[model samples]
Target: MSAPTTHRSAEEIGRTLAGPRPLPPLGATREVPLPEVVTETLPSGLRVLAVHRPGVPMVEMRLRVPFAAPGSVADPAFTARAELLSSAMLTGTATHDRVGIDDELAGVGAELGVAVDPERLLVHGSGLAEGLPTVLDVLADVLTGATYPEPELLRERERLVERISVARAQPRTVAREALQRKRFGDHPIALEMPSGEAVAAVDPGEVRALHAEGVMPRGSTLVLVGELDPAEAIAAVGKVLGGWTGAAQARELGPPPVTAAGPLELVHRPGSVQSQLRLTAPALRRDEEGYAAYQLANLVFGGYFSSRWMENVREDKGYTYGAHSGTEFVPGGAVLGVETDVASDVTAAALLETRYELGRMVAVPPTADEIEAARRYAVGSLLISLDSQGGLASTLAALDAAGLSIDWLRERPVRLEAVTPEQVAEAALEYFAPERFTGVVVGDAEVIGPRLRALGGVE
Candidate 1:
């Protein structure tokens, strides 16, 4: 083959490859049947949401308990105690020691994990459908009969402290911590994680007490999605968790207060080679009507790989390897956040470009093509995320907490499709405007700080 006398430049080749093809006529979305959801509140006040999803011979369980500490000023050690408790809860129970518990779970091809945030404690796991009873039994044993053995508590505490130390040294973590502090002020939630000293001070007695006080059934929700019948599952849950009762209701802290945005803070990380950027603002919850528009707007901006933010910052400017912005749902509300990491030399330029893109997205409404691509991605990803048994169960638990049901979830694609470019533009104007975001950049202050302040917005 003869070489071409003149080769097409990379830009020409790229444009040719990226040129849009005619979109086929959209087809009617195949409706996935909503699983039958049966909800039962036990006499002891434990709420159970059981969904019968056929096909898989596995059961996924998700439990959410309102585990926030009481008072505006949480005990300095509360987070530490809770972390230790979550780690040690399954180490040993009255009926089974740590080894025995693991062996029993292995026999059922199951595993369980406990996690805690400021607002809730989550217990999640999966097992064979035939092993549902065994899983529940083991879970109950851990919840009610956990011994909080001293040695296990100490081991977990040390491990967590080590992890926290490593995490605290990370640029992303430092950025997040600085942003939380600036946004929340002295609020207890601003603490994020406990100090290493606090973790070391936590003991078995404190963990046991935290479990006894916060792990009650009144405000906890158990969600099960599997091949089993919903009614049967609910009944089984009632039998096992019926006697686990408590009078104390889980405290519901209303939504966190929203701080006015646009104050950029700098977190000094000495000798850092790269800077972590995080821009965040208060956002709407999934249940809100405007949330659909907001979500589409986010996807079109930086929520996806092919978004405008990534196209500009990574593909065009080569300022960062990756960039993303998305909404994170917490107990009462949501926060929209954008994140990226860039070399120290380009930190200011990246921030400037980020702000420019944020402003431009609103100034220029998305094209029909952009809107449709984002819509398809949003709908397709939602379906894919719920394709598995575990994903379905976790999604159910979260939606239930938000007072939504499976039927609502099944209709998400339709809602996503209905989001218009006008709606996205409006959402961008309201939520994604650069002035509405306050954030932090963590880097070597000597390298990036003067330049950041010179760019305006940074204080």
Candidate 2:
């Protein structure tokens, strides 16, 4: 068939597309009931939280033990000891060698791994629901009886030192380390890991001692998510871990102040060809009244690909491949930041545009359409994240760590929907103002430094 000739004008088509069309009414929000969660504080002060999700045949378990060393984070020995301890915890225990532990995990089609940051040592285990008992038993064994065998510890220590070396050589890692030190100074919450030499100095005895002193269940939280009875899970946990005893309370690094204030902090990487830019500031807790508005504001700024910041930096100017901004929670507070990498030639221009976007968001409130789009994206992401077993498990663990409950999560859609354009603008004014941000730019000092210093924000 022959096509008919088009007679519609471009303006007419544009107007028709821009006009609102009738749409179906939205259905009432389907509220998923909170899972049956059983929480108990055992005699040893371990807080065990179990939830029965009842869909998938598998289970997810997470144990967060407060492993903060008593010494300052600035102490190389302290950082080294904590890192080696986490790496060695699951290498062996009293009765199980490394291979034996792997065999037990494989028997149940499960895997357990341990990781640590400044605040806690996290043991993550997952398996089929039928293997819950085995999972718990193995976890208990590692928690209470890890031996940190010398050969395994030494091998892991060497591997970690090598990894640290590799990480330090990367530009992003260098920028991150500089940002951490600039933001927190010598505070324990600074993101610096131990040096390679420090890791080499960590002996097996130190790992064992650190585990004995810091890897206690008292004040720790254990979250289990799976297709099982919550009561039964709790009982299983108690039977396995209840007798474990410790007197130390969880160490809280409430919130680190944004120490890299005043001008932008420049970490000079001589003869570099690119720059990593970080703009950061302290933010509010997730449960704060302003959180929803703040969330929307961040989305409108750079939290997603289609945001104004991304459009400005990546699409319009071609300054960078990607740009993003997001928030991370601490015990009682949050840190909000923007990150991007740019070629050395465009580094100053990109930084200027970033600040301009920050100022624009504060000065000119987002349009109604912008507000609705941002709000929907934020709320939809949250709901979608909890739709899977692993997602729900992680959500529960994270919120619990923040002292929030599942009910708070359930209520977030309404809260996000309630946020008005004005609220977002207000949040932008408060949290995203250019002056609220302290930054670090890692690049060729000769190329970007004078331009940055001339911009007046670089010290």
Candidate 3:
């Protein structure tokens, strides 16, 4: 084996990797305009949005059921019920066995999936236009009449238990879970993982009961069907789901209370060489005033690869591979976050630089050129995000679920274009507060602990 292929020296490797390449000039801008699409809403409260591109023979349907998380009832078993109910939907239904359902979908070249988030359960599927009826039929069966097989439910619960255990082994996942727990406190948003004991303790009856109550069609649903004949699509949905009736009123849960612990939170991970850092506070929802301005500010800071955070933290200082910031806009306001991994030795320096960059943005407004470039980038990116049928369906579904008007698709670009630099600066100053922010670092407790302590007290 040729002496097991001896390893090369670090200096030799470095020399071999040294090469230069051309790069795009700084502050260069590219502008692309997006096509405005039309939207319509049916009498049954189903929203339809379409982009008339004549190529694909497929339609994508996404049905969103709100209240996938716990309501204001404060039931301790709400999380468990939501999880078990969502999982059981995939196992089987009353009319079709698991194998039969899989074979049926494969025969028609259709796909169906269910996803559970903090706010909703989404049932999405796609098929060729000719196969849409069959796909819808299968989806309706699964969503309306899922039978929680006792044996399969037990098996899935075991699998999820093992998966949660595996997630515990990852430092980043553990740290984020911890941060959410501390930040959200008793709110349902903080419940990231369902316990193994809880999953096992949940019975089939509980899952069925939660599904019946929470998955009703009255105030609990928003349907989006894209790239199909609107009349036919709506008729098909109404014909199938009209009989599906329940009277559970949609509970309006208030926004999560604002809580801030400061700029530095250190989660100790033994024997770690680098620190994982997350800095965030509260920010505006998607429908709030200055939402567009907040987005533009984040884009100028860390939303894009060429944004300030990446330029300073990665390209200029070489403290990390990459760094970016983003906001999670739900029913409540939340601040943007800049997340990065840096060497344990330079963790404090990196944190200081991050704070300085944020402060600078607040002090000096972005130039007109920077503001326009950011706007162009944001508009172009949003266009690309809604390019596909499934993408269109998802975007509209999200908007409708959030109670926005159907004209949001046409109004988005105008809103983005009208954002001013002053607005961006003001929004950043109001939202991004380094003093009130929480910074959680997961790394070698022995090394990072001292560094964080020197900078400020780490919580």
TM-score of 1: 0.93
C-alpha positional error of residue 187 in candidate 2 after TM-score superposition, expressed in Å: 0.1
Per-residue CA lDDT of candidate 2, range 226-302, in tens?
A: 88888888888889876577787766554565444467888888888999999888887888889889898899999
lDDT of 1 by residue, 1-459 (tens): 997787877666556455944457887464555667888889877889988777879889999997776776645688888778777888998889899999989899999999887778899999899998899899888888999877877888899889989998777888887877766676666666888889998867878888888888887799988879888899888888766878988665455567568678888889999999989988899988888888888888999999999999999999999999998886577888899999999999999999998998878877789888888888788888888888888888888778888888878777877778788889989998888889888899899998898998887
C-alpha positional error of residue 48 in candidate 3 after TM-score superposition, expressed in Å: 6.5
Better of 1 and 3 by lDDT: 1
Shift of residue 427 alpha carbon in model 3, Å: 2.5
lDDT of prediction 3: 0.71
lDDT on C-alpha atoms for all candidate structures: 0.84, 0.83, 0.71
Whole-structure CA lDDT of model 1: 0.84
Candidate 3 deviant stretches above 4 angstroms = 1-54, 68-76, 250-253, 261-263
**Candidate 3's residue-wise lDDT over 350-378, tens digit each?**
98888888877777766777787788788
Candidate 3 vs. true structure, TM-score: 0.86
